[model samples]
Target: MTMAQRIGFGTQIRKSPFFDATLRWGATGFSVYNHMYIPRDFGDPVQNYWNLVTAAILCDVAVERQIEITGPDAAQFVQMLTPRDLSQMAVGQCKYVLITNTEGGILNDPIVLRLGKDHFWFSLADSDILLWAQGLAVHSGLDVTICEPDVSPLQLQGPRSGEVMKALFGDSILDLRYFWLRELDLDGIPLVVSRTGWSSELGYELYLCDGTRGDDLWEKIMAAGAPFGLQPGHTSTIRRIEAGLLSYHADMDADTNPYELGLGRLVDLDTDFIGKAALARIRDQGIRRKQVGLVIDGPPLSGPNTVFWTVKKDGASIGTVTSAVYSPRLDQNIALALIAAEHAVLGDRVDILVDDQPARARIVDRPFYDPKKTRPKAELKAG
Candidate 1:
């Protein structure tokens, strides 16, 4: 297959809003930014408030959804690839699952949404999860099918997501709960509505059959949300940084296991799954390193990768910051870092390297905020 055909979609269209909004927001332009893939015409703030905070906004996350399973052995074959107990996953339910190599190293982090008894959709990062799953299917000799679904996803995220959705769908959406999804027919087009999102706020995601419905969906959401102060917005990397969400490549990679990324709860080691043995060993023997939140005092003096902890008193570097941001909520610079297992203590002081200078840092409990999941999930979620 040609490279274009291999991508399984049309030529990538960067939402114009990405460049337009960044210039208007008075933030650093994308010229130097390396992480977030923004689109063209990514819109101006209706007022000045972040669009997500005030009203609902839509994002064409077409790049994020990729299906990698097809053929006869797809279903049963892919089950053993992750650490999650897939047998318990109900149809139409979405659960977070990790894709790993046989050695138990992470390959991609994706949400496994069981669409049918034998079909699955894995919304993943910019990784080769599809290829990985195919490799496993060939090795396992299971007669199942796997292939990327021909669908592009759009996200409606914001605090007023419900209000906007109510205006459009007429209150039918308010009943959906977090992680729940339903099929809806709008304008005679089939779409899957899921109360799941990436924004650390109340939101919902919609998966349409293709890009043909993109314009209509966008217009409808905006019109419905007008009364609720909805505004168009794009994904913000900095915001996620403060929210303590892990970015696949930035915060973790193949060598990093879920346990090392503070995702031990998601991995049911007790249940049979790939990587269980390695994780069990790590848990029993104890990890030599751990991921922790860092509270940095003073001005922001370092970027990610700054070492702030050591295994011995100046003996060797144990860990470095994987993610960091100047938090708008706490008005302090907070960071997520991996540190020596022994040094992972609450209120423990460590050293942070800032501008080649060692600065004193302290280990704080994670989340850095929202220790309690206090946000309520309304039925019609938008992100």
Candidate 2:
């Protein structure tokens, strides 16, 4: 119910190039992601949520670290990291993938981008995947160079994001298909633009090739977005929960496998990968618990949950709520929970303890909002 203690910064944690800009724009709080200070709140969470849904907003997501893998055997090496079948992945395409340990536990869920014939970047979540990949490479004697490139990404998201992007990058950016990327220059500054984002909305990510240009790029995009009601915003927790986007380390972690997180579609049993055998066995035994959505019948939560709340059935603990938010659009408190596989049914009723008080909840299908998933790829209509 009370605000969290303030975060202190040190050399142990790195700051993004846009840190100053976010602080200047009224960033009220911070959270560490991938060992970097990420702006967690700019002001009111509800307003930030609304702005992202109705207008355009900019987010400094440089914490989405990039693990660069390039070499003659780059593609081969990358394939050995995950269960996803990457044989058909074309250059300039992005795929949502999970890097698993040999035990079939999820290591990281990242958006794998193929930039060239022998180059790839894993736009990672909050995990030390770079070291994991490097260790693997060294042990396997793979012919590849692995490093974290100095590329920081900014996300321009919302319904009006396309317009803001068009104003800054020209109408040609409109042709960028969802989950695809393109390389371009802005005022001679090299950049990689991708039709991708965490929120289930029309959006694009601009990866800065020059870290020094971070302020310059932010200013240009903000100025161009001024006409479209652009605001400095942090990643929207409400929107992500509504869209059923999983947050790394919260919904799942290294101990959690793909099937438990409803990511079985991302695993390819036909492919040879590090966790293929373990996952195949998991498939045969069946998952014990699985992730599902929840509609809580209670008052709005006071703030973002700092700890996992217990989910119960018949006054007995049955699962845990990892992430929860009050969605104004849906007018109910929603949450993501990992519950017993048999209790993960759509209509199962359960109870959750929020702020130490009991509250009733029901199991629901994921993506409490935009279940049809038509927003992220929708074209911006003429204003």
Candidate 3:
């Protein structure tokens, strides 16, 4: 029998609805995100990566707090949050957007879903956008109700995720287009199912509307997916790095602007937003630093970097390695870094202080693997 894990923390930290279910399913480790305990370990992370890419894994990402905005003025109020052109956003469509501060710095990156003409939900990353949105609504003349609902999200990701989804909801689930959401019911459990996931694989995220049904929802998914080799797993850092996906607070934070991260595509200057003037000025002035990919010349990284490793070029500090990890598929240590734009040349050699030891590295493309994202956005076969 496995030894019982004891956790010591104050009541301030919240627990997800699937906490008990995950613990019963062999989740042995946890990490705090958005003031909630998230399962980060279920054994070997490398094995978890293989499971996510080869088969499928169910992740309790309940920490992705849903900030619901609904009111007569919700449509106009939502547009003031991000620079993205939501004018053409249709009901049931989801958009990945950035919430910025007055300085144009990213406050939080959330996926906004248009549930109705004036109803929306901002499924957030690590930061607290609920407070930000609520605080903003206090003074704005817009009529909107901003609050956190009883919703929690679970990611069912991998190449085989489709097959598993079909088994659960029938073949109709396969027709759901990418980045779109539909209200669904499974055995009396109310949910908002979306053809979206963070794994950069063909996957789905099931948003449990009722928190009380967490255990029931988790068990149902696992049972339905057992035939397809489904495993209880955490989000894979390796696959995310390989896909060139960014992690908030690691790859970016409140101080990081969209242009510096090459995410200017998410910023639409033509639209009026909270930080439009600041972003416009930054765009005209050009960015001083840029985020890039690097191939660290060393043994495979044991795990993700815990600190910002210093990057130097010709004995001068140029930038810092934000996030670094070994990609088992690539068989190399790849990293994402923010460095001076002048030193961001591809194929340029730089030295990074890994664990206080000097290691040689070369500038490479952002994504070490699929550049065009063909895997996640691949078209499904018609019947």
Winning model by lDDT:
3
For residues 1-383, write the lDDT of model 3, one tens digit per residue.
Answer: 34434546788889999999999999988889999999999999999999999999999999999999999999999999998989999999999999999999999988999999999999999998888899999999989999999999999999889988888998888889999999999999999999888889989999999999999999999999999999999999999988889899999998899999999999999988899999999999999899999999988889999999999999999999999999988899999999999999999999999999999999998788888888788776635
* 1-383: candidate 1 lDDT, tens digit per residue: 77634543223434322233334434332211112244423433222226665566666565665575544544565567777767777778887778866556687777777777676788887676767766666667577666666666767887777776667666677887788677887776567888877666678888776555566666666677778876565565444665677777667778887777777777777566677788777767766778888887777533334333332225457687777666555767777887777878888777766655566677888777655544425334444
Residue 209, candidate 2: Cα error in Å is 0.9
Among the numbered candidates, top TM-score falls to 3
lDDT of 2 by residue, 1-383 (tens): 35465545679899898888888888888888999989988889899999999998899999999999999999999999999999999999999999999999988999999999999999999999999999999978779999999899999999999999889877788889999999999997789999999999999999998888888888889999999999999899999999999998899988899999888899999998998999999999999999999999978877668799999988888889999989989888999999888888898889999978888999999889888879998965543
Model 3 pairs whose backbones collide: none
Q: What ordering of candidates by TM-score runs from best to worst?
A: 3, 2, 1
Superposing every Cα of model 3 onto the true structure, what RMSD results? Answer: 1.9
RMSD of 1: 6.1
Candidate 1 off by > 4 Å:
1-37, 40-49, 68-75, 300-316, 355-358, 376-383
Please give the lDDT score at residue 329 for candidate 3.
Answer: 89
